[model samples]
Target: MTEIKQPIEMDITEVVKATGLASSAIRYYEKKGLIHSIGRKGLKRVYHRDVLMRLALISLAQQAHFSLDEIAQLSVNQKVPEINRNMVHSKIEEIDTKISELIQLRD
Candidate 1:
């Protein structure tokens, strides 16, 4: 008979390593409702593996100038689309303007 291997479960420390975010930031995101955690085991926080992907998306959205509240709105549902396209477009325009100003200043 062949032996089968079980998948390893990740803990909060592993999640921080995979997402490249500080532990505080993860806690803040959870508080802001941008991400959720699985019920804790003892004093340690536990999370599903999918949280890595959620944190990645959150970081990318923040880099694009979205506020925590706005990001929370976008992250509300994975099954249903929650992002407001117009809001995202406006934010993109704002970021583009800032980039243009920086380029002009450097010239």
Candidate 2:
């Protein structure tokens, strides 16, 4: 018989390793309601494996200059993160305008 191994729940250290984020950052996200942990493991927060993906999306949004509040609006805690198309479109337009301004200055 073959053994199946899986870590359905991960402690904060594991999440930090997988996401390259500091433990403090993870806790901050939880405090901000951007992500949640299932429970605690000996003082360490244990999160569902899905939280790795949520953190990834949060990182992506941050890189794109979205505020934490804006990312929260996406309902990051949900299994499938919800995107507000109108908000996304607005951001795209904002980016386009900034690019145009930068190009004008460069020229």
RMSD of each: 3.0, 1.3
TM-score, model 2 to reference: 0.93
* Candidate 1 lDDT score relative to the true structure: 0.78
**Residue pairs with clashing backbones, model 1:** none
Write candidate 2's Cα lDDT for 18-71 as tens digits. Answer: 999999999999999999999998998999998999999999999888889989
Go through the candidates in order and give the clash count of each. 0, 0
lDDT of 1 by residue, 5-72 (tens): 63345577878888788999988888887777777878778887777767878888888878888887
